[model samples]
Target: MKKISSNRKKNHLAWTIALVMAAPFACASDVNFSGFLSVGGGMLDDEDAVAYGGYDEEDLTFDRNLLGLQVSGQINEKVTATAQLIARSNNDYEVDAEWAYLSWQANDFVKVRAGRLRTPFYMYSDFLDVGYSYAWITPPQEVYYLPFNNVDGVDVYLTGTLGIFDTSLQAYFGSFTDDLVLSGAPADAETRNQIGLSGTLGKDWWTLRAAYHQADLTIDVTGIPISQTATLGSFVNTLRTFGFNSNADRVLVEEDDVTFAEVGINIDTGRFVAAAEHVEFDPGDAILSKNIREYVMVGVRAGDWLIHLTAAKAKDEATHPETGIPVGQPLPVVGSTNFLIGTLQAIANSQAIERDVLTLGTRWDVTTGTAIKFQIDDIDSPDSVLVDGTVVSGQQKVFSVAVQTVF
Candidate 1:
């Protein structure tokens, strides 16, 4: 099976890397370590919009503290090994050997590296360090949608010249595991085994990158909730009165298959740096409704200020996929439109769906590595209106401000 094969490949990659690391090496000099923390306070226009209230409308948190220690020293003049430990919010950490292995500068026309490393999935992925990167406020959530974007793997990079233009070729193989919670269900883990190829070509002020990737993912959702449960006490009472003894269990689980692919571009000319990305994800039968998610965003920097404008929309057609009713058309009902009755009808008449989002924001660097950001978003939905003999309108606006920095 494809899944079996992918799993095997990942296991093999891990074993191979472990063996390479185990082969004792010559003693290297001093190791290096550094880290930073970004504590922020923010306010949201409406707290109800958040799926969970881990963050407050106004509170300070070390949600962005990153502790990293790297060890790197040269083997001869051309070979090196580097490893890092990335810490999380709960004071826990993971070994992120961002770059480990041997590099051979074969010649003026070719170069190669082998070991565990990072694949250039996005512009910022290569520099996810909190202390070094700009942004006290996290990057826009619309585009930075992927919860975890790294792979434990091996990579090969080739660099050369094509007349007046320069080029680089990169290929990689690896696997990654991380939890994703799209709906109100318990988190599920997505394990990915993948391989990809990317290339960059350009002259001076301009360069472009194109990449193709294929990943096999298995989603484990055993503890996640499937459908809404009615009142527990009511169900238990009815069962007891009927002289039935049953261990009423209410839990749902569904496995999922996923595949993701993306392409993006970046450009910088003296006083300005511009970038944009477009990505798509297919969560086949994963959580509940979302079968596909797609979005794109563009941003620019000028002076000490960064102005970013983004628009993104996601539609989960499966939210109310089946209402246990025959599908054809609306049922005609004569009488005053009752809010409760209409709401029930809407639930029964058609599957509930939503599409809405518009975002705009700006950030200014007030100091060397600290900045302030303000953002506003407007939400709209067509089906939000109730059938009250007339259309009932509903809309909400969200505004937020925060300070971010790394030390």
Candidate 2:
């Protein structure tokens, strides 16, 4: 696919009109361009500060604004190309090509694509683009926690009917790079190279999938604060450093390797849909957990309103393949098992992952291209918890409202 290199805002009014007029005589193939822009503002219902690592949540900041453009064309009966570009608040005015792949149809039952492509590791990977999909916003964060967005590689897809069954299989091998290690310690210059496979089976309203991923990790050290006068001061300095510094400072990743596996299913009737997934990760000598992550969600649509409920949980522990050491050791610190100590333990146990969350939200389609969303989230942490800029012993709650639209 040709990369969408232009960032200029363009008008396609004349082209659209001509295409519509020529539709009758056009072949089965065509070129289509579509995109969406979503701008929204939201706030945390409570004004109090909630601290996670060392810093309090930025007080009710502007919700992220996102834009995406997609262009696709069928070159002939057996060839096609697709390209997508996305812009987000985190990158300010910068826009990047998110997906650009060339596909070849080998037969009625098989097709192949290679290039920079979306990794089909999760349920929504294929249709994450904003232009032609419906959703008040993005999927929940807990269910879609992949660190790297895309991989440079190849995909083989098989889709056809076998007897009474419809089947799909996708297998791919690819490598990815990101500043933060995908499943291990946060090395300053972290890298991961991965290979993965996913398959699906479905007929009518039911579908199922299983995916597996394995990667080699590499870490490098570039720049970071060496020391601080006090513990709190040191922690605060680290947070501020990461927040303010661009990619100038560097750190080396001492140990490297990660493995992940996931399986999921989806069922949809006219009025309701249900989905669930289970994922697991092994830290492989980095500062993260070797644990299992899982979640389930259900949604119902009635007229112009849609309601969704989600529950998720994660369990952290020592890498099971390792031999006879105690499962894991508690982080050392003064004053019982405190928040700071717990967070460190959670980090060091390179495997201490225990968290559960429940979220309830409703989306109202106010118009063709706009929607309003309100959600209530309840969080549970039996281990010491980080509270409003302070350490607390247990559960937490948060509420948010978002107005999302496309133009």
Candidate 3:
């Protein structure tokens, strides 16, 4: 959902490193090792086009290069520890832990996990970082938009059968703090009181998934003061100072409630496949618009070769509040009250999402655990988006190829 900034701290105590450093003390036979790697490159073909998935017309780069290693060790009869350490080329090869947790098998049908875990907000959340786990070189950004992928938390998972459907349920609560890419800028951000619930039912070649997640989000992007408070906050404070409290309440983002909801259906037979998902995001009282995104895909497989086509789109709904301030009324030293209100409105409108992308791709299995893929994506954004008050082209055509292997 978000790109990590390059200036992240490097000396933090990551659970992946902690677990791996302690691996030597455990019995060598108790620990198992597995890994995956992907090396990819792509280029955009048009001038004045926005970048997609980090590919641009300026230069062809291997930002898609990534390698990850996983280790699991049995701690006891009922407990086990697992960790995954990943190095991404885009992050300057800095190792990060996508998963590090201890699982306790309470019974045949129930399990508990604690420590760092993936946020189960999407159908592919568990393997979101693993390119080999999915058919597309990259999942649709419209639907796969979220910045926090992992959380420090605990979760309970239960599995059972309901008549003809195999059912699994997951419930979790956690917190996440890191640098977030908001409005194309890196900012210090945090999410708290984050809770999520997801369930899946499957039988035969058909599967169904639904999930809901909500959290209190805060992004610190401080700047010039419109008054005594910060830029964003001064608007609310000024509104309150002028006794227009209702308007102020509509645009406050400090610890505001944000939610995500999604539903997905998939069907697959040996030679044919189809899948679709719909997702919505609501940021309560924030200066960002509500967003809805969806995608549909169909594919066919013949022998070791497969072809697929995908269509994805995203739309935004504005939640801008009419501050009721008179327009263009001049003030002393500071613009007009309308300028303050218009700034807030522009902030909301700037984040409006309007994107549609059509993708044609193919995959070939070169060996038992290795595959090669090529894809072309035609993106069309009928409506332009604003970034830092600047308008730019949103259409880009990208061509890419990748080699993925799991060992």
Best by lDDT: 3
- Model 2 misplaced stretches (Cα beyond 4 Å): 1-29, 46-60, 129-136, 181-193, 221-255, 318-347, 368-370, 382-395, 403-407
Tell me which of candidates 2 and 3 scores higher on TM-score: 3
Error of 3 at 157 (Å): 1.1
Q: Which candidate is the best by TM-score?
A: 3
Model 1 stretches with alpha carbons more than 4 Å out: 1-26, 30-37, 50-62, 90-116, 129-136, 179-192, 228-258, 284-302, 315-359, 362-407
TM-score of each: 0.63, 0.72, 0.89
Query: Candidate 1 residues 47-152, lDDT tens each?
Result: 4443111343433343434455554545555555555445444333433443455556666655566665565665455655552364314543444455555577
Task: Give the alpha carbon lDDT tens digit for every residue of 1-407 in model 3.
Answer: 36665334422435544555466427645777899999999888775667787676656666789899988877777777888888988888888877788889999899999877889877778987677767788778788887778877899999999998999999999888777666544567788999999999999898899999999987664432333334655666666766667777666556989999999988888799888999998988766679899999999999888899999998888776765767787765456777667766776666787889999998888897888989999998863544345666777888899998888
Which 10-residue window of candidate 3 scores lowest in summed lDDT? Answer: 5-14
Tens digits of per-residue lDDT for model 2 on 1-407? 01112323221322332233334224535877777776544444333433221113435555456788766677677877666667776567466666767689999888998766788877777766552244435565555665565776788998877688788888877765444432322333323456788888888898888888777755432232222333322543443343422111111234356777889988888589788888877766654456678888899989988898989786767532222222234333423224333434433453355778787878888898778777666667664434234554435555655666655
Candidate 2 local distance difference test against the native? 0.59
RMSD for each model, in Å, please? 9.3, 9.3, 3.4
